[model samples]
Target chain A: MTRMLTFLVVAAAAITIAACDTTGEQAMVPGAKYSMNVEDGRFHNIHATGQKLACETCHAGTEYQPDFVTLSKYADDGGASPGIVDRAACLGCHKAGGIATAWYGGRATR
Target chain B: MVKFIRMIDMERCIGCRACVAACYTENYHTSGAPWNAVIEHEIGTYPNTGLAYMPINCMHCEDPPCKKVCDDMGAHAISKNEFGVVLIDYEKCDGCKYCAAVCPYGVPQYNETMMELYPGKGRTPYENVSDTDRHPTHRKKPKVMEKCTFCWHKLEKAVADGKTDRIGRDPEYTPSCDVVCPVNARLFGDIEDPNSAVAKGIGAKKATQIKKEYGTRPQVYYALVGGDF
Candidate 1:
């Protein structure tokens, strides 16, 4: 009985360790081997007017690309006008009055 | 001291965004982080209007604010490599967002959720790719504040391959964005090399760094849109 209890305890610990390793759920990426603390999700509320998209959501990549054009057209057309966004396309991810809605509201008028 | 420099000719820049894409693919570990950015501003009054496209990357300042603040935390999260490149150690970063807030250029980006490239499936190209494989000169830590390594990985690879002299001149050693630029507006090379195209261009055009008042002493130089008066 004593042996069985010890085995079970060790097995449980092993399983927990294996689970964490497999998931890579730790704050840092697995095997990266560096130390830099950065906020993972602070810009969720910030959204653009035309697309109502956060800068990170679309521009998220390893290196920067200069070919991104979706926002350029909107910027060109709207010129100085605010809020003249494509509402139908924006509503796909952001429902009316969501965090995005408030953010876009301010940018559209700016 | 051998200094490196990047030169941007606004007249030749067509705003293709190749640099932004290369940055994304190379630094996918920080999936939502932007190491390079392009800001388009309209200049002049109505009828004679024009659009100015500015591609901004980490200034790699001589006195980088990001490095100063990171050091203030006593963590020494940021450091300048031997080549004068500012880099962040992801493992030490506590997700504090302090560096991101202090950057005047709004270059550093934050990632909130740890996203798996292929959630249900196993690792994908998006998951396995690192800065080393992407550029060969820049190696980035995942889940950290990653920005442009200025294609340092490529530079390192060139040196290892006994091709140090070929850097900036060789397309493979150049940053993906710089290589893919159809208009040939962006130029990269050792600023210390007097014969390099970047040096010649800078000497010929009187290239200038952005927001010099900030005293960052950015290595990246630019030739303004309007002809020098």
Candidate 2:
């Protein structure tokens, strides 16, 4: 009886270990491992699109190709706009009214 | 003693990433390796939110941890120039990546092979550097640990030509990142010289260096970017 009970316990423990290792429940993102904060979710529209802004609008130089219309000579292979992001850049859009709302991560907070 | 160092003023920096393009072109770096980066970190919540453009590169410390560990591992590839520039002697390097593993700031980038512009499609204009004498500064050895030279080759030329005074002021002597900055946010010069602009600026703004707790004593100073320590 004792031997049989020990064998059963061992088998159950092994199965649990295997299940934990290969479990598909925690499907992770590619570059997310490098991030210390975010966990398991990359949801969009999780909150009110209270003030949705296009990516390229605030975040500059994200366009596929470089914009060559400016006075400065920029190399074509997507290397334009070296002076794109700064503290002032944020205040440019997220100014007085845009920052007034309490953003709860677009609904992820709830 | 130059005590070479860099100062980045967050107040003026616009995070344009021209520094990135400048580094890429100047170094002849392939796509995978990014020598300079402008880190955009969002601070506070929606009502109080703002962004900080933190441009980072090699610290080029007074006592570099990368050099210490590499030498201990019997690879004496890393050496500091007289002007306090930390350099890697490529011939002595064995591509161990030990320096990369030990670095706190993740400054060292490892390359396994020289990447072509279009895989068997030959090289680009920037990539083709067989004739350039400064190829050592621009090119990388496969499987070796490489990081920012602070554009040491440019500085070396400036010094050799008796233009040491022009190190930080001139485009030829200044690092590409410093020269291309649209806002004049980047400042490089002899930190030891109290009269120099970089030194005075550091003093006036109360610039701070990262990882003093780790005792790396990084030469790179930021005016108002590092979190309150």
lDDT tens digits by residue: candidate 2, A1-110: 99999999999999987665454223322122222111322111111121234445544656634333443454454644454244234434323235522111111100
Q: Tell me the number of clashing residue pairs for each predicted model.
A: 46, 11
TM-score for candidate 2: 0.65
True contacts kept of 2: 0.00
Q: TM-scores for all candidates?
A: 0.61, 0.65
Candidate 2: C-alpha RMSD to true structure equals 15.7
Report the CA-based lDDT of candidate 2 relative to the real structure: 0.68
Which digits, one per residue and each the tens of the lDDT, describe model 1 over residues A1-110?
99999999999999999776554344222112232332333232223322245443533422323444345654543223232233233333433255432211111100
Q: Write the per-residue lDDT of candidate 1 for residues B24-73, one digit (tens) a residue.
A: 66555444666777778777788998887888988777667667656655
Candidate 1 local distance difference test against the native: 0.61
Q: What does each candidate score in C-alpha RMSD?
A: 16.5, 15.7
Q: Give the candidate number with the greatest lDDT.
A: 2
